[model samples]
Target: MKLAFDRGRRTRAATWVSLGLTFAVALVVELTFADSSKADSPLDSKGDQGNSQVERGRYLARAGNCVSCHTSPGGPAFAGGLALNTPFGKLYSTNITPDPETGIGKWTEEQFARAVREGVRPDGAHLYPAFPYTAYTKLSDEDVSALFAYMKVVKPVSFTPPENEMGFPANQRWALGMWKMLFFDEGRFLADSSQSEEWNRGAYLVEGLGHCSACHSPRNFMGAEQASMAMTGGEYTDKVPSGEIRTWSAPNLTDVPNGLGSWPMEEVAAYLRTGRNGFTETHGPMNEVILNSTRHLSEGDVRAMAVYLKSLPGNVGNIGKAASAQVIEDGETLYNVNCGTCHQPTGLGALSEQAGAKLVGNPLVQASNPASLINVILYGPHLAKLPGPKRWKDMPEFGSKLSDDEVAAIASYVRSAWGNVGGAVTQEQVAKQR
Candidate 1:
């Protein structure tokens, strides 16, 4: 009986050992195949990889506005050094050129895709949110591979930007893993079956690569955009041409009183392509968008974006009430004195390129919130430097010449004049912005 019990114990031990070996072998095989599968994706498969791929990638890069953030003012394209200001501190953009030591020349295709889509470096460090990989995560594997192919062939420059400056916990890159866990979702875009093909394409670009909400959507104290109030409006800092940093608010883009609710889709497309559409001229960051990105896009894409944007519902209760009679009369006089020569007495701006923007039926002039109008009047337009035909003439700044009350009057007049029902501008608002 003792001998039989000893044999039973040994047999059980042998069974357990066999099960452990099988599990270990299975894990090894799974890990090996997983890595190999990623490397051998259809997107990474060898094919006609030459001029066409590079050209397509170039278009995609332009659509993504890679150069705007990556290229510093007066710096070599893609060499990087652009300072991105955050509430905590400044973070410098990285060089994306093909330089072996400085740029991404040594990275494998899989590594490049991982960085673009997953915000993870080859060494497995989490990238800061400033990289916009949250939006890029929706990019398809094929598009990422194409971008990688294009980046690999770009003019390589041996340059490194300064290290990012953040205080304490904000500077720790490892902390981003937690941030991603909360906010980031890793996946490619899926076309909505319910939407039209054009709408779907536009939605993909806007929600993913364009990341328009980064600036347009309000953020909480944690720096995450408020998805609930998307495209409603947000305030950001912009450097004026005179080197002074000014607080500028991106106006609501939704179909509401203060937003793009009244704008025609065609006009929106025209504005994106040319920076002007007889309503308002693009300035500041938007100028850069037109110069570096949107202007280069196909007309179809621009139309698609316009269509998608126009479909958004605006805030119903956000509309401003009409101004008092005395305020309107006071504003008209100011408009006549300061703006009549350029914009004409009737508020129908001159047709000449050197003249002022048209006020009649102009969306910017009729916006419920007059922040953009005040900004343009105070700081003037900063024309984007681009290699193309001129879009719009520059406007002069009135900050030095006009008092806060006077600027408010002119803005109020424009908003209320010529069948426009936009509300009055306030001196207090003007003073705060100044």
Candidate 2:
């Protein structure tokens, strides 16, 4: 009886000690992050206000793809109203324009910096990860200041975004502080001394302002990107402005067979700059990326990005087998009859923007999955409406005209033919994407 009592007492004491330790840790973290609110800006004393600062900010803003998320279609630039669909609920972007009433105009420089890097609002509320502050946290003070300068100079429109539609506990903004405690690592870009300046620059742009991993890397149920599989590609589904549901497979960016390994740096740079290379064309979300962000960048920056991407460690994923002899034969027949005139008998379509787009050795064609290929075949590009040079002509949707088998056959043929070696796609795969 005495021993049992002593054991029970020990257990209770241990429990109390654990609770105390947890509270102490929580207090330390809260104090650490809250200190960001009072953080000083090195640029505070510079007093560097001029067109050059604004212009530098403009470049940084473009690199960050600020307008794409912050602005709605037909709305004034940066007057945020875009609805971002997440597992929790639809979250609308807040206006970052300089309007005193509706936007960040009232925010002090310190307030803005804290929001950008620490994901904390001026009111001490936590922001959702949908804002991509996880990646933005790596931004340097200079770039952050430049971004602020540019935003302040933009024409501020008087409009407030609608409230986010988060369900239940997710709506509790305080909980996001816990989420940050678990995942957020507040820091600036640390250049690898071993790499060249260009490589480091590219790494900074891709990992920080570009936030490429947000879409390319697979995410957990909670939506935090998997660090282990960074830039290896993943699945993304979204509802378009037209209310059509669309899904895309962001291809791997590594230098593996499943990625951009075969493509030259020039091809990569061209694709970024113009939305089209000789090999493949950008459509869907990538089109918006090029139109709004990469296309506006200088040639040197674009080249540097390509250099960095091509240097990532390769990660080869589950690759399917080549189509059977019978499947290829049927696909060849269908291709000749339905797809040949445009894509050509050789599978190398014309280079002219008005003509058919190149398909042979196209990276999208060679992706591990056939979702993107099937999507374009069924829906014909589902192109985003944005201002840019029209680099590729939109193709007609053959979803209704061609049966699933025929579509699969043609896709298989494209994957296997013209020096392309991507594995054959299945009918079930085609049906699901459809």
What C-alpha lDDT values do all the predictions have? 0.70, 0.73
Worst 10 residues of 1 by lDDT: 28-37
Per-candidate Cα RMSD to the true structure, in Å, reads 15.2, 9.6
Candidate 2 lDDT tens digits, 1-434: 44445887886555444432222212100000010111111222333455698779888888877877777655667888877654445667889988899999898888998999998999999876767788889999999998889777677679989987766545667756866776679899999999999999999999999888777776544455667877777666654223455556777787876678777888888888776777776666676677768888999999999999989998755457999999999999999998888788897788665567777657677777778788888777755444456555668889889989989999999888877777898898888777
Against the hidden true structure, what lDDT does model 1 obtain?
0.70
Off by over 4 Å in 2: 1-50, 239-243, 320-329, 352-355, 382-394, 416-429
Candidate closest to the true structure, highest TM-score: 2
The TM-score obtained by model 2 is 0.81
Per-model TM-score, in order, reads 0.79, 0.81
What stretches of model 1 exceed 4 Å from their correct place?
Answer: 1-50, 316-329, 344-350, 360-371, 384-394, 412-434
* Poorest 10 consecutive residues by lDDT, candidate 2: 28-37
Clashes of 2: 0
